[model samples]
Target: MALLYQFFTALWELTGAMAPYILFGLFFAGILHEWLPENFIRKHLGGDTIFSVLKSTLFGIPLPVCSCGVIPLAASLKKEGASRGSVLSFLISTPITGIDSILATFGMFGWIFTIYRVVTSIVIAFIAGIVSNIVGERGDKDPAGSSASPIRPASFRADPPAPGQAGGACGCDGGCGAEAERGFSFFEAMRYGFVTLMGDIAKPLFWGLLIGAAITVAIPENIGEWLSGYTWLGYLLVIAIAVPMYVCATASLPIAASLVLSGVSLGAAFVFLSAGPATNTVTIGVVRKMLGSRSLIVYLATIVGGSLLFGLGLDLFFDTMQIDPRSVVHMEEHGGWATLLASVILWGLMLRFLLPPLFRRKRRCEGEEDSCCTKG
Candidate 1:
């Protein structure tokens, strides 16, 4: 009974620690989505080996997409004629992390581990793109050859707005909307950014918190400890399990931290950190269909190969450097009150990010109903 109470308490505290930042990250992600046009991405990014890979990584890094979400984006890119190489690079990088995931990684793994995670994600993305371009056979014959028109013509301009079809108040449309026709203002843009962000990220933040709590409660400490002894096996287990399981980078960090404290090998935790986002069934299927079987193989190779190599390096670093694993674990004993206070503040901030948008949506629906009733 005492164990059960302790588990629930730990779970609640963990959720409080992580939910706020993820909510903020989601808003930033929405702003990026609204601002970044697909045409711009296609024009500069597609082509020969090196440039394509670089652009793919750059474009993919900050996007809020998770392992499941990467599938549709990669597929859409392929449909829009993004080179197989660029698509592969984006696939490798997209699931890795963003601002929210990075912050969560820091909260869980500390600074050094987070750095390694981000750097490795970039390297894997670039290498995957380049290698696919080099080794994979180009599948389709280009009917137009060099004369084929690029997806976006250089002279083409975006469609002009209709009169009175004012721009969305959310400055995300770059003053191209009806509001710009009336008057452009910076404060409106900022307002839009904040509101749009609240709408988009609230669901994921809620889900992440719930999942974090469940893992904290359900998993036993000894399970993690037992696996630590077989570090390599632990990595393999994480890979095998995580490959089929879908988890975003930010949400996975707290669970990894808990597992680590429970005695799971750090190497295994790193594997979960890397592979959880990179290779999943949805991402794999999309790669196979859009990029072809060969590109799919290359994508898997990149993530699996990179993760294994990094995991081994981490294991060696911990073993040879004699780093104390216990130092990473912050239990209730040391600075417990401080940790609790911080956790509460974080949860409050997350609540602010999540609740307002829901209220707005409800109000909007109510207004629409009132208008319909009046018309009737």
Candidate 2:
């Protein structure tokens, strides 16, 4: 009973610390969704040049898409004639951090960690993109090196079919967000942020919170102090799980912070934050299909290698500069009324979206598909 109480207490505190920033971030995410020109990404990311790769990395920074969500968007870019490097860049960059994620990261981990995350993601993304371009020029190119080679798959070069056309495996996620056309309204933007975006994330957020609280309650305190000498092992462990997992950027924070509180080095936590949101099995298959085998290798190698390198660099900087990671960790256990209110509101919103589908599933499970119990 005491253990249960401690678990719930930890969960609520984590929620209180993150709820307000998440709401603020979601509002801005909606604003970005509506205001950013629909064609802006497509227009600037077409060329086979360094600038195009650079632009894609910058553009992906503010997007709120997760690793899975970004796959189709990246495929659409590929279909729209964006260079391979640019597509890979967008894939790598969009998922690891975003506006919603940035705010939550700062609220929980402080500005230093937040800034470092953003910076390192951008650098890793840019480098991955540049390397892809180089590999494309050498290995995936025409004899003249002026364009893509004939050996490239036909599906890779084909444009997606027009509306209602669904024949090919290529550009599969291209229509992932093809909502019916509607006039722009501020209210609608807020609806997307609060309702649509929140709904998409609610399940993962719930699990992250539950798992984080459980870790906090279960792990022995200061275990990290003993594990400090094996930071490399920690990094490897984080990567092993994170790279194949499907947690979204915002959903990953509480788990990372809890790991920190439970004696995991900050660098390992950073690894989970960086690698988890950006790579997963589905995205891996999509990369191979849309980009090719060579590009897939570049994509995976860059993210895994780069995340490890940056993770180590972060640890070195902290030790060399005598920075105490715990001091910067901002897990607010006792917040004001605003925080409590936001936590309640956030939970309510999550439940509103999460429970209905679950209830329907339960009802269906209780009876046959044609039975009354399965009826809506």
Candidate 3:
């Protein structure tokens, strides 16, 4: 089908350049998954108040989770007894930035904007989390309502378990078995993380690729032209459009840059940049259950409000300071080799991750336990 081809092409393009970073990010995520404890998340974050929200926001800031990856992880955190505020904070913070995204962002938008993004995201997530808690129920209430939490291995805690012990190895029911002893080594954990991330995201990636390819091939003209004259309205529209979309945080960056280059207002681009990957429906539902309805309201308000205000502030700053944003595109010519290299690296990483399991068993049989495999 034409649609199917478009989808695959899109997938290839989106995943083509940055696949390696994504893989490495997954590996680290698994490591943290093994090392971190759920009880610590619960004890420290189990409160419907400002302090808990701040704690979660701060905790989420440096971790390198993107939109597609954050959902299950946040849900898992909630299932592990993390407070609604903490979950809310994770939801808000996870998408806006991460280690992979930060590097990608720095590459595209220079250090100043990158720094602005990280700082602003943290501040916004914290404010949103705090507001959610204030508007939501007390901790004593039925924290687990209509929504389902993540399936956590029972041994999860804030503190890392003993060196030999697996953190959070208790399957959802807290029963231990022989399977539990097959602790995942770092490489194994990394592989699992990559597979898990792919499994979780493949659907969205398929859809996104289809849409992106259509936009690139069929809609080459400037799509934001209609709102070009009305800067503020255009910015709001960006938020509305982005909230329901499932683009990755970093993938959205180039598109945002392209929009900005096309005479779209910086504010509108900022709206797209911030909202495109952050406020999708999955996160919305997560917010509803984790923060409670009232807190969800606050969370949405914070994102929408914060984005608009920030956009406006940025616009004024650029104008008042006479700061002209450099072009998102570099040379007038394309970087063919750069593109090819990026593609090879990305695809190579993906293939390496997807294929190793077929051969890794031999290493295991040879009595070589991979230290790189995570044990969570």
Tell me each candidate's TM-score: 0.73, 0.84, 0.71
Each candidate: how many clashes? 5, 1, 18
lDDT of 2 at 351: 88
Those runs of model 2 whose alpha carbons end farther than 4 Å from true positions after fitting are 137-183, 357-376
| Residue 345 displacement (Å), model 1 | 8.2
- RMSD in angstroms, all models? 7.4, 7.3, 6.9
Cα lDDT of candidate 2 equals 0.77
Best by TM-score: 2
Off by over 4 Å in 3: 1-43, 79-81, 138-150, 153-170, 176-185, 192-194, 198-228, 326-339, 347-376
Task: Order the candidate numbers by TM-score, best to worst.
Answer: 2, 1, 3
* Models ranked on lDDT: 2, 1, 3
Query: Which window of ten consecutive residues has the lowest lDDT sum in model 3?
Result: 364-373
lDDT of all predictions: 0.63, 0.77, 0.60
lDDT of 2 by residue, 303-335 (tens): 898888888888888889998777667875547
Residue 133, candidate 2: C-alpha displacement in angstroms: 1.1
lDDT of 1: 0.63
Q: What is the lDDT of residue 303 in candidate 2?
A: 88
As for lDDT, the candidate ahead, 1 or 3, is 1
Instruction: Give the TM-score comparing model 2 with the true structure, all chains together.
Output: 0.84
